[model samples]
Target: MLDFAIFAVTFVIILVGAVLYLYPSSRRASGIPGLNPTDEKDGNLQDIVNRGSLHEFLVSLHQEFGSVASFWFGRRPVVSLGSVEQLRQHINPNHTTDSFETMLKSLLGYQSGMGGGANETVIRKKVYESAINNTLKNNFPLVLKLVEELVGKWKSFPEAQHTPLCAHLLGLAMKTVTQLALGERFRDDTEVISFRKNHDAIWSEIGKGYLDGSLEKSCSRKGHYDEALSEMESVLLTVAKERKAQRKQTVFVDSLLQSSLTERQIMEDCMVFTLAGCVITANLCIWALHFLSTSEDVQEKLYQELEDVLGSDPVSLDKIPQLRYCQQVLNETVRTAKLTPVAARLQEVEGKVDQHVIPKETLVIYALGVVLQDSDTWSTPYRFDPDRFEEESARKSFCLLGFSGNQTCPELRFAYTVATVLLSTLVRQLKLHKLKGQVMEVRSELVSTPKDETWITISRRRKHGEQQQN
Candidate 1:
């Protein structure tokens, strides 16, 4: 009997060891709170995916499981830092840049030695920032030009016509960014038109379905993607060659030409920024219009700011700072829309947030959208009130992630500047009206977008039109 008991104890010990090794994610984040195992009845992947909009689902997680929560993204454990404290601990900005930025670099394959390693990456990053940073003045005219083109196009349609706002916004942003990045050739090149079509096709077919392997699984899409991507590469490479030979101008492509990075490197960076900027900027315009369409009072206030700031003068850098209320409207727009709902960072070493351990090389998500509207952080978190940003104390209370926080990304700033330009131009001349009986639902894509067409009628703002005519 004694010998049988010893053998049974030894067998149990071995089995327990095997189980722990096989399912390390369970123990890796056992201390964190999240969905009950039973709640995830259909497996973690399916449960999270089916939870309606990602914004709503994340809000539910924060409400039910507190701020710091963990879940399985497939077989791996993924922790979401949903509280300000959790974000501070895990997202030590002084030590590392935004994980979302890093994730972007990795996804766009920018980190892969553009010919070298850390130094190469750093050099390219500096070039990108420098190229874009000095362009507000240079780009403003291009933006105005594009907005005028868009305005004329909108006016061509019959009165009170429903134009697809997202598509138009996408064109405005794409034209602006590409013109800034590539240069004057964008104005007349036939390849520019071809590239835009390819870029949009990639967004519809590949951008939304990238993670699910649907991109790779569908032979038809895969072929279409490859052909489009290849053609885009050819066009960009041709442009790069021309830029390399030309007078050294200060455009993004010119700055890239001055770098030691390979042609492929420059092309990829341009592609990434153009693709990202198009989606985010377009969404910004779409949501800002949607909110303004529903709220006439807000529109009237915004128009007042534009009138006070410019008084029929052209939009310029010097005048931008004086439009505080327009800035507030934008702040409110980003807050309500949750433009970038989630951004992930790969933890290079083991770290802890709120006593919860983050294992090495684990992908950790910063729930910016959830934190932005956290009841503990914002007053009347669900309301779309721009005045909330009127107080300095409100901003200091919690970080707005990529919006106005001190550590906000440059891309976000670029989008903000572009959106402001568009709004200033439009609001000064047009009045936007929401479609009657149409309810808008936001779908979680690479960026969040309305499920229904952003249906709205645009008419010239009567008073402003009279001012313009005079």
Candidate 2:
């Protein structure tokens, strides 16, 4: 009996040793690269996604890890590219796999059933380019018309102690975009206004839910989002149906109807395009105006450029080229504010960059905000200097990644044109001032915008007598 017990004990010890030796922990003896599993604190991945400080965290990581760094977001490996050169190489137009729709579907639950196929993508790009070219040819009259409408509405308002300029600007932007896109205005339409309100609310909630990773929750907010999307689709479908019956094709929606897509497909595309254009362009205009309100020198310089080129005559499409400074100001605003801060793509197939193989299905984010503000690439990176774009060399370096990149969205050109028109019209007419010492605070959602209740006061520019005295 004693000999048997000794043998069993020895066998058990040997088995236990073998098991420990073969375990994964023992094999590697360390955590995986880009993933720190042993850290007691919340990992950097959680820090970036959940903490709501992605911008700050990315900047810090870039500072510590150079232009390229590997990080994980919820067990998913994320490779952040911050160099302009690397970004340019990666954003090849031929890589249709890295499309905006695909990325957005993953991020925001947007479904692109309209089938923007490879050929469709090419055609869409041409359409957008044509639209922009047309805007450059004919936007001034449209701009003046929109501005006149906005000024009339502003004048009619009670001049209350605090007029919500953000709301007012947003309304104006929506009207202007709608007019430009469809050649029809819906500013005062009750149904359109309600649609705008609900759409904005739902989209804002969706953005918050996406960042919070709570989109799956079947809560009241989710219901709101569902309802908003349904309502928007219904409205768009109704429009499509009516236009189809009339056989009168005019605007973007009409063009979409004429495309090789079904009515439902056309409806969905129209909804997405219109909603995106309205929201982002509106927020951009608001932010740009907010910035101009604080910087008197910048505002004055813009006014001078407009006045010098326009010379008391209403701005014309022919005069857009002469407003070069206006374009610089708008470009600077986009770079500094970054309406769409982070653009994402997915590796459809295995690819190698500098001998580092990215496996299939890797998520790649080109941090545009970081790249635009990189000190190495931009001089006085933080300062709002529009003059940087005045030189051809500098302009080439400053990539407006808003349009025609791998992650390009279809509405970018339209947004740019609308912004240019709005800025030109407003700066030429009004001297904007922030109320007292109130500073604008930025809030980032689908697009970056000012915090709630942000206000700016506008007064007409003085005559030459007052200007000379000042």
Candidate 3:
């Protein structure tokens, strides 16, 4: 027993000594200039393992460390950026290749395949753009129809009761996006519904596991993710098989079948498109509605804008560009809420910025939540102010919220359209109000949403006679 105890103590001492000697921090007493790893005092390390809440930790680091700071997740070194200018510099097309997408591939356990070579990346971008154009052209009416359906459902509920904005938005987004991307044949099909539910469940688990630093220990989550992927592949494969049999060519599945991508690649891309669109679009709409409920003035202003442009007629794709304030509101909501808060990347080559040398293969993170709210970049950062985006200069700076440049999300165009159409329809027809004295708490999981599920009482607007009576 004495010998075993002595051996264990010696082993621990040797292990600690080895870690101290070989760790990246040990190799250099000080980090490269302009970039230093966040210490324990900044709450960097603790944030990773804490119950999946990273917003406060990230905000604290930015307040303390300025734009660039490094931190460790176990043995992995991560650098976080808080400035849009610095993030833009790193994401320049000339400098890198789809950093976040590459990181996503690793996270999803897909083969990198030479990081989707430059040519392939460019092709994919064009294909994605074409897909967006096709989807909007073919499905805007369907999206509006879904909105109408939701509104009809809302009207049936008692005026004293509030609708579950988050769940309703999630269901609407899933139905609309699935119908648009996969076509009506699979829209409400049992297999499709099952695939979506299982995939969403898995993704939610994976996101929670990652934020909690328990991704490796989440065998159930891993199983769910793997099962979801397999089921998704089966669905897409069936679609491909059906399309081939009918000699019919639709946009998404047909495009995938014709591409040089393998079966797995096709499945992954399809999954990314379908699942990402649902979560992001749904969350964005939910947050927008939540804010609108709290800010009656903003909602009235938006209604006026919608009235001026849409004029009580059913919304069409052509009128989308004319709803300028609606667009701004969505932009501000995304900026304030930051649905996709932090994006991670790995430096593929050694790069120099200011006084620091970022070594190759180092993990870099761009905290959109921090950068979007930086005092230097935004005025009245905490306020829900859409007017700030009315100016050209402000809009230009706001472009960093991921709609322009090479780093932009491929589905952003689609997301914007979906959100605008839905918001315009709802605000124009419904009088939505927050429950009295109810404070909606923001919850951060895969995305930020209201904690209590964004309960809001919505009623159809009266046709002037009822308004006069009131």
Give me the candidate number with maximum lDDT.
Answer: 1
Worst 10 residues of 1 by lDDT: 36-45
lDDT (Cα, tens digit) per residue for candidate 3, span 1-470: 99999999999999989976565444331273222324433223456555346665667766777777766665566677778778767766333344445555666676545255766666665665566577678666788888888888887787778688887888888787777776767566584567667767656755566555565577886677677767777887776677656764455656666666676666676666777777778888888888888888998899998888888797788888888888889888888887777667777777655566678877777777787777888988888898998888678776654644444676656777888878887787788888778776776654676677678898776655565322
TM-scores, all candidates, are: 0.87, 0.81, 0.86
Model 1: per-residue lDDT, tens digit, 1-470? 99999999999999989876565533545467775332222225545556754456667777888888876654566777887777767666322354546656665445633456556655666776676666655667777778878877876766569978887887778778778878878776474577688887766653344533346568888788878777777877888888888865757777777777678888876776677777778888899988999999999999999998898976887788788898888888877887777777777678888778777877787787887777777889878888888888566543536567656665677788888888888898888888899888877655677777788898777872355432
Considering lDDT, which of the candidate structures 1 and 3 is the better prediction for this target? 1
Q: Per-residue lDDT for 105-166 in model 2, tens only?
A: 56545443335555665565454434434543454466668777776665454433455767
Return the lDDT, model 2, position 311. Answer: 76
Candidate 3 Cα deviation (angstroms), residue 295:
1.6
**Alpha-carbon runs more than 4 Å astray in model 1:** 1-11, 23-30, 35-43, 52-57, 93-95, 109-123, 155-159, 205-207, 216-219, 397-400, 464-470
Q: List the candidates ranked by lDDT, beginning with the highest.
A: 1, 3, 2
**How many clashes (backbone N, Cα, C below 3 Å) per candidate?**
0, 0, 0
lDDT values of the candidates? Answer: 0.73, 0.64, 0.70
Strongest candidate by TM-score = 1
